[model samples]
Target: MNGTRGTIEIHLKELLEEAGLSKNKFCQRAELQRSQLNGYLNNTITRLDIDVLIRICDTLDCSISDLLEYKPG
Candidate 1:
């Protein structure tokens, strides 16, 4: 197989906006640090934590697919 990999995009910012939630509020509700959330928002997180993903999904009442999208590279 080729070494190509798809990108995993995080739509946290858009989701938060759609939910009418501020970053600070979301961080508080998700029990996440502002910097950590910022990493996800900026797409700079190298690793995806399942617990964090679950927290975000639970807090936003959204499915994993709503928060992330995989695009072929």
Candidate 2:
């Protein structure tokens, strides 16, 4: 193995779970496009739009820190 391989990850699924929100309900409540939300949940998103992130934070009553975590390899 080489050096450290790690990531600062968005823990969207866990936050959603803690909030008791289903994908569909969250989309409707947060006014997020279904595809975008799906992208995040599935970890298939390449870029996260800041506007959308703010909207989600406001809607969920969570700070950005609440949705993200840092892990070491």
Candidate 3:
């Protein structure tokens, strides 16, 4: 796979840090699994289900932009 194309990186940890929340609490509030959270943290996975994304945004009390970021090649 290309290093950049079609890849999405999420700054989930950074956002959570800014919000002063722990991973466990954030995951609980967001209703996301540990594996899914790890994937976003490690940048090893792309694509989020709409439901998950919505939950995260809701938990963070922010828009999608506040929880996620995009880098393009």
Candidate 4:
């Protein structure tokens, strides 16, 4: 699965793990709806809502760069 891909993915799960945050806790702290966050986790997130992203970064005490990563395919 690691090598089977088209576009490279963001390392959001790693960031969440590093922050020691569960999706439930993150949603509460970030003031986001659970379903919306689940959508992101499930890779069904079509739009990146800036406010939600900002809230998540702030709640996690991380920069946007820490929450995101880019890899070339």
lDDT of each: 0.91, 0.79, 0.77, 0.72
Instruction: Estimate, for each residue in 45-67, the C-alpha lDDT of model 3 and write its tens digit.
Output: 64567898788888888888776
lDDT score of residue 42 within candidate 2: 73
Q: TM-scores across all candidates?
A: 0.92, 0.78, 0.78, 0.72
Q: How many clashes in each candidate?
A: 0, 0, 0, 0
lDDT of 2 by residue, 1-70 (tens): 1126755677788889989989899999888989988877776676668988887888789999987666
Summarize candidate 4's per-residue lDDT along 35-60 as a digit string, tens digits. 88776566567567899878878887
Candidate 3, residue 30: CA error in Å?
A: 1.0
**RMSD (Cα, Å) of candidate 1?**
3.1
Ranking by lDDT: 1, 2, 3, 4
- How well is each residue in 22-58 modelled by candidate 1, as lDDT tens digits? 9998999999999999999999998889999999999
Candidate 1 regions with alpha-carbon error over 4 angstroms: 1-3
- Considering every candidate listed, which one attains the maximal TM-score? 1
Cα error, candidate 1, residue 2 (Å): 15
Off by over 4 Å in 3: 1-6
- Residue 16 shift from truth in candidate 3, angstroms: 0.5
Superposition error at 22 for model 2 (Å): 1.7
Segments of candidate 4 deviating more than 4 angstroms = 1-8
Return the number of clashes found in candidate 4.
Answer: 0
